[model samples]
Target: MTTVDPTYAACPVPLPESERVLLGHGAGGQLSADLVTGLLLPALGSAAPAGPLEDAAVVPVGGVDVVISTDAYVVSPLFFPGGDIGCLAVHGTVNDLAMRAATPVALALAYVVEEGFPLADLRRVAASAGRAAAAAGVAVVCGDTKVVGRGAADGLYVVSTGIGHRPPGAAPSAGAVVSGDVVLLSGPIGSHGTAILSVREGLGFDADIASDTRPLHRLVAAMTAAGGTGVHALRDPTRGGLASALNEIAAASGVPVEIDEAALPVPPAVAAACEILGLDPAHVANEGCLVAFVAPERADEVLTAMRGLPEGGGAVRIGTVADHGEPGRVTVRTAVGSRRVLDMLVGEQLPRIC
Candidate 1:
């Protein structure tokens, strides 16, 4: 007879039936949400976070709120059109903190190297990371390195941990979004994911496509400075792209979100590429842009502030949080004046994409 663990047997909610982890679990979509709510949270028991998840955690330390975020980079083909794994690691962590309206203070980096990895390549990556950190106005204060046997690890992997200071009035969160809030996109979408996919598959197009992988802390600073308490939430559409980000915000805030399809800023190259690949631009990832939920009264000033910065020069109003609808619902008003429900990406569209 086989023995069953009491913890697994006694839980009121059933876990996923699948015995093995799937790639979709890391895709930051529906499967990922299920994994967290069903498996991870239950397993963690009292140790799990108490509220809705955010990109970074704001903890009060010594009477001051400190924001901390950690991310691991496993993007394949280390080098891409506009960035490499190292700089990406830095930017990613910084952006996570930025999403919470925090000012980044310092970073800690960790590296895992395969046994046969090249020293010159490692140095190149390190130099890139240093430059990125400098550009973001943050320092890598500490780090650790580990080596594993060949094939045990990829060529290299980087993990970045960011520490930031949250201002007294700065408390942007997904759950803070409210009905009648305006949705703003910092810039165009699909460029980053398209760039990575183009490089990975050797796709060619008329225009040059580059990954929009850059830091957005300064952009956030500007928005918060101008909008003040009106800025309710911020999110970087990365893994599951804009669709996933909006769905998350809606679910957390228990509000319906509606966007106009005609207003989405899809670059020509990205639009063409997505059409060819049969992928929705809304589901494509981005690195250098953010989604903002701001009160209508302050939306104009916030838009002006964002446009004043190069990073947010192309900012545009895309949609609004509805006053009434099914909670956690999202809909897109199509170009033909038809409305369709928009759900989060079901599975991985582009794997190892930042």
Candidate 2:
């Protein structure tokens, strides 16, 4: 069981009243915490926040624990078909901490605005964030704002951080993955990537493509409750998508992975976009989906639990973990039943599409 260090203080940094967040706020160092406790928390309330003050926050809840995570929003074209960057940011960080089987608790937001940005747009984004947080059953406890010189910053960028508690007896980590573990995907992938690409490229399609951005913490909690310790590792297929995420897990666990291409889920619109762009859906990023690694005996249970969630309604067991037949290698069985190497993403495919 992980224990919080007794020496850890509720507010490690000196509290101060600041009107705006400086670039130092994003450093992920001492200054960041100072900004949170000193300004954000007091404004929100005196109640102490949870989570490790690191990238995300972890809090204790009942006998089981929870964790909170936060992230910034700077994706261009703040508005998208399925959702906006505002909602995307909330879900992104929430899902990150949820991958640890932690129940998300609260979120804090910070927005940087260009001097001439429309107030209506700002209100829309803020409202979206609040609604999204509420839908996930997490509160928006604190926030900050800053206005930059016109043309100096994008229209607006939002940074949201959350705190959650990890349940007792849950051992979620990439390192826990072992040979014979099965790999599972929460649902159809590449929707977010394709949606972003379509908007950016002005590609008109008969199908309306939208981002798959939504909170996944509840789904993760369900899977853990159902499978218990069998859920070895969980990772959201984000920035670099499934291929990159799988490579990281395989390398970290010193295990080889094999995914069946035919079993992989890809929505029809996403498949069409990938075909037109010569992009592999596996290499495309997803905002509201996750990849889970589970012990073989409990894989079905975990998959069932995931499928029961709205976000994971299409969950599928796609592959298995194995002793590295070739160290650091990830292979995929193609549609034709032939194996092919899946390499890490070398460079950006759609830069800033996140």
Candidate 3:
């Protein structure tokens, strides 16, 4: 088991004091946590999830543990570099199931389009969603469409629900993370967030940055095949990026997570963009990557397995779970060797960036 280094300190970021929902609440950070734990869960009462919230819920259905996930895509512009709202809907829901080590079986879509929205665009989105679902080896079995008055719907909105089957005895969850588990990142971070920002704001750069929107179930399957139960926890850092994802895992597992800042694989373009915008790469979003907690002994094997897949070609070991320190603590060992608390994203950096 790893021991906490003395260099780390308490988180310097203050807890949000707002009484009402803010845009940051949708950014998937500390504010989001407050919204869920404060309002949503209390309102849900007995219907709330018993443990830490996860990307998908595992329910016993007819003697089978079925994984179900649902997500809504309201990405601005409908289309962004490397992906569009349509395929994004499919990939997002599928990735959630994949985070639980589930094999995607079927998807359902619901579209809300404004009356004035172009029919051509709607057809384009449908075709794109079809292609994405087919490539992921899943089918869209059902759907609904609603057309609203102009400005009622923001061009278009897609809601996707995914059904998946978890392999028997394979349970990957945030709460399953433990001391000595090695933290591995599937690939680089911040690409999707930066790509969306660039296009939405019309900020052109010397090199093009594209959203990493793709299905990761196959990549996850490869990992489970190699690591089995040794892959303790899995999460796709989407909205609040790696920082929020890691913080949630640390809080759920009640362990200290420490990562080397220099070890994180951030693309140069993403890095430059974050630097330009005064955003932290750790707090930026990624559409098509995952963060994993693996048994320390099986880390190399799992990393190798991940690297073999095109989706995980840049996989790397970033950190470890510490046996000592405050529960739910996350620290970053900076380049100069000083350690500080790596808190969750405080507010909105890039809005409507899926």
Candidate 4:
């Protein structure tokens, strides 16, 4: 007999219901989709008419393929050192579309304000969102506003939706990955996670630890320009970090992934924070970094292109995909020459990590 951990049962989001809001409803899975389709879409009038709403909605406009993705921001402690929730929301959605090799075009903003929330803070958050969008060269076209009862809502949450045009002949997906493909990391990992944890736990570090949240469409564009079709898959190791992202690609491509532990780039501050908190840096979150899988032949070219971009200055090849007899097996080569399996996060090691 097996016993389920009661702690896992205590989810952060509500469950799905006809009228009631549950934490599970925001899980980004089936229940979340149901909430959007069954309630929110109906009430707001279906802005997206297409049936299958994916990570991004693809639309054909004037012979160009446009991809759009939207996400909400409710991170506790509205402001952090490197970024605020508002800027994070913008980067999150824009990066999602960029992962598809799309050039970001426009953005839509939505605000849900709780009663008693300071007007000054709200204005600041909005300004941050606008500035982030502008910095990314994306426009804020439209939006909506809502107010909830004081006790029923958090201080302020911003939801941003972004649209971008996919470059011609660009194919981006885990399915595009093939054996012997090289895996690359844009920069050091675990910064965002450590920053959040530091603030939440009040862990004072010697250096300023801040969230590494920024838009990556420009970097993606540069890589695409260099390697084009040779770049197989691009993922922004956001929620589950590099380990989970690589595992996902391996599973989807039916390939084996091998990573070198010594090659992984982790900031010292981030490593220290992870050690103190008993967290694996590989499984920590990153907002500004990306993991790109490219053909081994073009890996160097891709690296050169990435290094030219401001966001990918520390880009390095960390691993490769190959046949390991069994499909979807991921192994990490330790510094001592030992190998270990890298498995999917069985359960939430850290919740609300994204």
**TM, every model:** 0.94, 0.81, 0.93, 0.84
Candidate 1 local lDDT, 83-167, one digit each (tens)? 8899999999999999999999999999999998999999999999999999999999999999999987779999999999998
**Candidate lDDT values, in order:** 0.86, 0.75, 0.86, 0.77
For candidate 1, which ten residues in a row score worst on lDDT?
Answer: 1-10
Q: How would you order the candidates by lDDT, starting with the best?
A: 1, 3, 4, 2
Q: What order do you get sorting by TM-score, best first?
A: 1, 3, 4, 2
**Which 10-residue window of candidate 4 scores lowest in summed lDDT?**
1-10
The model with the greatest lDDT is: 1
Off by over 4 Å in 4: 1-57, 61-63
**Number of the predicted model whose TM-score against the real structure is largest:** 1
Candidate 3 — which pairs collide?
Answer: none
* Winner of 3 and 4 under TM-score: 3
Q: Which residue pairs does candidate 4 place in steric collision?
A: 13-23, 13-24, 14-22, 14-23, 14-24, 15-22
lDDT of 3 by residue, 146-255 (tens): 99999999899999999999977569988898899999999999998898888777777424688999999999999999999999999999988899889888887789
lDDT of 2: 0.75
What is the alpha-carbon lDDT of model 4 when measured against the actual structure? 0.77
Model 2, span 1-354: residue lDDT tens: 111111123544455445555654532222433555555655666575543222234456675456656566667678877888788878887887888777777788899999989999999999898889988888888889999999876788888777777757666775567899999999999998789888878887425688999989889888888889988888887755788678767765668899999999888888999999888887787898989989899888888888888888999989998665874578999998899988655443555555
Deviation (Å) of 43 in candidate 3: 1.2
TM-score of 2: 0.81
